[model samples]
Target: MTAFAEERRADRAADAEQRRIDAAAVDARRIEREKAADERASRLNEQRQTDRVRAREAQARTRAERRAARGEALTPGNVYRKGTLALVTASALGSLPAQVLHFVGISPMLLPLPLAIEGAAWVMAAGVAYADERHLPGWVRWFLRLLVLAAAGFAASINYTYGLHLPGLSAPDRQAAGIGLAAVTLLGPVLFEIRQWVTTLSADTNSPEERARRRHERKRRRQHRSIAQLADRFVSAAPFGQLDFEEAFAHAWEIETGTSTPGMTPRLHQRAARSTAALAQAQRSAVGDSTGRGLFGRLFRRQTESSPIQNPNQDESPQSITNRLGSDLQESAPETPPAGTEPPTPESADPAPAVAPEPVAGPVAEVEPVKSAEPPVLRPVAAVESGPRRATGRVPQSARTPRPTRTPDELLTEARSATADWPDEKLTAEAIRKAVRTSSANGRLLRDALKAERAERAVSEAQAA
Candidate 1:
């Protein structure tokens, strides 16, 4: 019973220990969750702070831009433009109401009459600006200017008459009021016209360099009158706005020169080719090249004349030189008396003066050369043929794989299939050449065909849309 009691105590202790462990695990998990939540809350605060700071910065930048734009400190021209706009606005507001009232007194339906008159004046003023921007004829500008003055004059007269007939004014006061009304009524469009003139006359409209360019262009047109006419013709023939004046002029130059490149001609190209080739040939001839013309012949001839000569049988070869050296050795070999004859002493030697050797050095008595039983071998001279050399980094024609020639339609069909998913820019001449393994010319042809096909497809799609 004591043993059973001890086991019961131990079981209780074990259960207590397990409970404590579970409590500790729960606490640890709770702590971890709290830590994660704290981290998330901290991150949220940081993100909110960052966004607030960014918004403040953006607002500050916008405010600064607004300030600069309203003040026009960054652009002085804006000051003039905005000031003119204000003056014109004030003038129009002062004049337009009087005209409207004067006309409205006549008829309610005639209210639009004053507005039309005022609109006509503004429209003519705007027409002057449009004419200037379009580089229209001076006559067109003058005509528009005359219309602006006429509209303004008509409005001013109406304003003056309305002021004169006002109910509250005396005679002299009416005249003054009439003059003032007429002056203010005319001043609005006149001020706008003046502003337009000032903008046109501003030096910034055309720089000195820009003026020089125009002068140069005009001079060139005068110099090349025919080319200019051709350029005009080309401009007229092309679709509107498809080609600019300069590009059309370039095409004209190409046509006139009979070449693909503008300002160059086939005749000039041939002449240049001849000149360069002649210079290269002259340079080659001046130098002692293997192809053989130069001072080499003259120099070598003089040397041969001064120096001991070689055998006539010698050709231009290493063996020929060796054979010549051998023959020389034999000729220069010390002569010996006949086998039976005694050698001559100084006493019996002839006292003749020492003499120089002849052109062909030899002994008075000839000794036979040692003959061989077999005939001498004759080696042929090495001949260097000047034919076209096989190009390095290229396969020989015989070694290359023979590719069957493909027609444009067949090749284009194949290319289209091969490159269906490829982008337009990737379908260049070189890329097509590598991908299709075709000639450069054929690659270009295929590229053009594919481009045309894609363009047509795009056009059709757009039309369908």
Candidate 2:
């Protein structure tokens, strides 16, 4: 029984050993599976990391592309600004040749003035490049441009004249250099203007649509500039920016030509200025006329109003009435005696009585009865049966012709007034007689007129002396 038990224990021990071996194998397999699983997990994590890296790289590439597109989009505006800078730089550089010649003693006499001019030109160029020309006065900008061009030409000419014979250069090289410099100098103004124009057109026009709009605007500006130049030549020189371009130019054209063009008319400001001037002139003329009338009217009123006070004690006789009316308006007739009384001797008759007194040719002088307390008779002159008519035939009273009446002093006044505008040389007695009558004139009236003329001449001479 003890031996059987030991064999059994040995068998059990073997069994236990076999079982341990199987367990160990199982453990080893489990370890191997865990190792394989860890390796697969690590491989999968690596693949995920690679995918993330690829995604990041793709995103970075897209960002780079987007940045490149935006840069391209912004390039035009920057380039335009750079072009302006370049033009200004070139203008400044145009002074180099003359400066070089001066430094080398080739153009010593032509140095200082040209150097100063070029320096000023450079400063102007820089200002013009950065500023908007539309804001500047046309004449000012034009003058500055001309100055710069002149400076460039002067510099180029000096270089050509003095620096052409530089020691190391061949004839061909010298000629080529001279020609090139001359060409650049002559074209300096044009090149600068074109460059400035390009800069202005390209500035702020980044997209194609904006550029197209700018081009259209430039075309319109060109048309307006041409019209403005024409208007300036014909009319007054109104600078740009001081007025509206199209309207100002149109008004100027109308004013200069004295007629309007087909599609253009004058502006409101131009019309307003003219209207204001005319209105002012009219007002001045009205004021002057009113002042003159008031002055003359006041003088006449004072004269008429004071006449009664001066002659209050004098009787109102026919002679006095004649004198008063003659002094007032210089139109009174000479006083005559009544029909029954003999005619008064003429106040202005000549002393010589060789010629018989002739009848006056103007209005008949008649005695005008004065207004008195007594009523006067109004009877026709009964023909004392005048001599000639009764002796010729037993003519009826109605058929008898009355004697010719003498002219009054009132007709002499009319004659004087009629000849007022006549020249002094044309105011002879014969001319006055001819103007007064187509036929013969009265000798008595002529003699009176002659006396009056002599008196007037004496008075004028005394005053002049």
Candidate 3:
């Protein structure tokens, strides 16, 4: 029995050992699964971080591109910055003399005088720099610079006079100080002129090539000015709904030569083509006569016609011929033939009545000559009687009188009048010449322009009268 019990105990121990091994295996599996889950989570977090970094980088790139597109990218060198520095320095230097004078003065303070002088100097310096860059004549530059310096000296004198309380010393002291400063300011410009003269006289003076280059530049400038002037005139003269190519070319020619020319350039041809296209577009927008009539008849008809209906039915045409006729009769009957002229009798009048003319029909219609009871009497019309008598076959005096030709002075005056408001610095004879030369290719266009201008002037005069 003891052996059996010992065996049973051993069996139980074995069972317990088996159970412990199973628990250890299950725990190991759970630990392995938890470690794998942690690694996966860490990898996911790392991927998210990477995506965020990429997005931020993309945003930065986009921002940089936008700034570059707007031309706001930072650049190191700038002319305005240099000019500002120079202006500041000049202002400081200019105030030195005024400051010295102010310290010597008693009673009233002279802050305004020094400030004014400094401000004037700075302004003058800026002007000088601008003028120099603009290629103003050296003599003009020097003159302007001296004027600025003189102004500064005058301000200093005023400070002394007012602040020092020495009214007697004001005029004389001012004059003396002004004279001294003027002399000093004049020194630089005078010396510069002398140096230029000496250089011009020296063996190393500007070469012939340089001189030729300068002349060419001047010519180019003149041409550009002429072209701009011509363009301006054309723009001004052009009808609101019509492009004036002929006028443009004429003005261009005048700019090219101080007078009218016979031709136009390739550029002018292009301009004319563009203008014609624009005019066509404008004309499309203009409400043409319903009958599609031309200038003389259509204009007269429009002036005479009255409004038909304010919101006519859709079924009704926008324009009605009967309505137009009624309007015309009302407006134009007063200007028609006098009632004293009797209506033609059936026997005297042609059997056929005048009808609406066909587009292809010639002006003179073939009509049968009617046999009259009384012989035809020769009678003078009012137009013939009122005007000076001319030979039966001769041209009228109005047609024979020569039109006045445009003089250079007249052309120049016209150009000046057109550009009167433009700054002198902006105006250039070269530009004018260029514009004229460019339009010299088309002679007919120039002639047409002149005719149009003359017609317009005549119309304007008549209206004024």
Candidate 4:
């Protein structure tokens, strides 16, 4: 009975464990579904906001396009004209009362005289703009301008007379009032006339760049009046659709300059070519400088010791040019072989052999051979630097990583071990450097150590004998 009870408890525990896992899985799936729904809601809200913003932008674009088609959009010129009109109106009102009173002193019928005077001046100012719009003769615009000035002058005189005799004013006050009235009367007409001039000239409509271009064009026409006239004639003669003003002018310019291109003569082209060649030659000399001081030295290189051979690319004044001889960047001659590489002759082992001259383009060097049983150790000459490519710009065969530095003793030990089996005559410093992959200085030192050892042994053998 106890065993059965324990088994039943175990079964119950297993069922509870399975139920807990199933509940956890169901809760996890519910959480995942809620997260996905929230994400969808957030994305839908963002898309709605985006669509609203785009709709607003599209509406604004449509409004702008409509305004453009009607040509009634607000402009800076409209604002300027409106502001100027307000000022002119205020000036007129300020000065017109005194002028009307001055004219009224004569007769009541003269009341309209001041208005007529003021209105006529403005009419003439407007007429100047009208003349420009109608493309009228220059004389017509000038006539209207003269009338505007005459009307403004008459109005100013009337205002001055009225202010001088103003009622309830002291002498000084009356004089100031008269001056103020006269100034206002004159300013109203002048302001109006200036505004008309601005409109007529279309000065405010043109951008600064457009104005500058027009100024340049006017100057060019003045400088080349014949070209301008010919261009104008050609433009007038050309068929309407076949040629444009600029194209016709271009043809006329070519004909007038007697060249296919405008503003270029054969002499000018030749001069340009020469200048380009000189510049290129200067570049070659600059890059050819082997010394790291190409920054300034090559540019300011003195003409001293400069070659006389005039490079076709060089300027005629050879004194001012920088030239480098032996700039062909030839490969450096093979490194001079060491003394151990010397061949064995029938004569004494240490006889000084005549050194063969290294092939070079410049001056040759000669070494005199000496005849002695035990000749002095001949120091091998360093390779000639006539090749310029030693330091000049040459494409290297391999990356120039510096070898690990070792001490003199370490270098000697390595060389001795590597070349011990080699014959004495074949044990050259160049050979040791290649065999051990060491520097020239270390190889030379090792070769000398071996030679000294050989000399000491020969002496010891003689003592033994």
Weakest ten-residue segment in model 4 by summed lDDT: 313-322
Q: After superposition, how far is residue 247 of candidate 3 from its true place, in Å?
A: 6.6
**lDDT (Cα, tens digit) per residue for candidate 3, span 315-344:** 122243223322222211012233345544
Residue 308 of model 3 has an lDDT of 34
- RMSD to native for every prediction? 22.0, 29.9, 28.9, 26.3
Backbone Cα, N, C clashes tallied per candidate: 0, 0, 26, 0
**Per-residue lDDT of 1-465 in model 1, one digit per residue for the tens?**
999999999999999999999999999999999999999999999999999999999999999999977777547677777787888788788789889999899899999999999899999999998987888999998999999899999999998998899888799999998898899988888888888888887744369887888888899899888989998888899899987988888878888886667557767776666665555446433434321223323333443465545322122244433344322323231244335544444465434334433332222234333333333222222223333222223222222223465544555667778878999879897887677766555566567556655654553454443
Better of 2 and 3 by lDDT: 2
Which residue segments of model 1 deviate by more than 4 Å?
64-75, 82-86, 97-117, 170-172, 203-208, 212-465
TM-score for each candidate, following the candidate numbering: 0.41, 0.35, 0.28, 0.40
Residue-level lDDT of model 2, residues 64-157, one tens digit each, is 9999988975697666556656765674466466456655574466556656755665556555655555557666766767776776667667
User: Which candidate ranks first by TM-score, i.e. highest?
Assistant: 1
Per-residue error for 343 in candidate 3, Å, reads 99
- The true-versus-predicted C-alpha distance at residue 426 of model 1, in Å, is 59
Q: Which candidate has the highest lDDT of all?
A: 1
**Candidate 4: where is the Cα deviation over 4 Å?**
1-80, 132-142, 197-205, 237-243, 269-465
Better of 3 and 4 by TM-score: 4
